[model samples]
Target: MNKHETYAWFRVVFIGTACAWLCWRLFFADATGGADIWDRNRETMSIVSYAFVFAMAVFTRPGKGVVADERDRAISAFAAKSALVALSLVVLVSATIIGTEGHADLLTARSNGWFEHYLFACVMFGWWVESAICVFHHWRDRR
Candidate 1:
């Protein structure tokens, strides 16, 4: 494959890995009883994510070859569209779930669970949704 495809592959792998980590943390944050590993886990994931994005920003589409050829643009466009829809669904569901309890002492109620859980869930869910969209884009483009 060419540099563009290589870049895309790396990008997907990086984000996919990060998303996997986020999902793991979300589910197991309590299993570890919120130990130092939890903090380290989040920090490492954040650093890796930022580093990957920075590398992509510096290295991606580094040519006059349409900045992003037709396929790349198409894949990204489709991915973004799907991500938007998926994010909207997440927000709507979160709002619905949150509203169900009517915010009665929201920040204090034990019933509310941790706010970070929802935040992490939404972020990871959005990334996964984008990854799925990108996969669909690749499959469709290939066919």
Candidate 2:
């Protein structure tokens, strides 16, 4: 596979694994009395995520040959449009749920940084969605 296809697959895998682990740790692990590694090492994990993004960018950097062609750009554009739609749905659903909780609770959640965390999740979800779309399109093109 070409670099773009390889990167798309890698992005999907990495983001999917990370998001799944995070969701489990955040929502289920505590109830099951499982490990609290995520809570204890959140800052470290954030740094690691940043490093991973940097590494991916470096991996996709332009070489002597052409970096991205028209097809790659088209795939990315389509993926991005779909990702935006996914992100909008996530936000709308989250907002609707939060809105049902009333203004006082909303203020409290905001003060507790719940809103910030929600925004972070939204952004990550957007990237994951985009990567997944890219992977599907790339595979379809190959077929």
- The sequence of per-residue lDDT tens digits that candidate 2 reaches over residues 1-143 is 78888988988888888777766644455432222443445567678778988988799889757798899999999999999999999989877876774655435523223334446667778889999988988899899
The number of the candidate with the highest TM-score is 2
lDDT of each: 0.63, 0.74
How high is each candidate's TM-score? 0.65, 0.80
Candidate 1 lands at a TM-score of 0.65
User: What does the lDDT read for residue 100 in candidate 2?
Assistant: 74
lDDT of 1: 0.63
The reply for model 2, stretches above 4 Å from the true place, is 31-39, 102-116
Regions of candidate 1 where Cα sits further than 4 Å from its true position: 2-4, 32-42, 64-66, 102-121
Q: Single out the weakest 10-residue window by summed lDDT for candidate 1.
A: 106-115
Candidate 2 achieves a global lDDT of 0.74
Q: What is the C-alpha RMSD of each candidate to the true structure, in Å?
A: 4.3, 3.8
Give the Å shift of residue 104 in candidate 1. Answer: 8.2
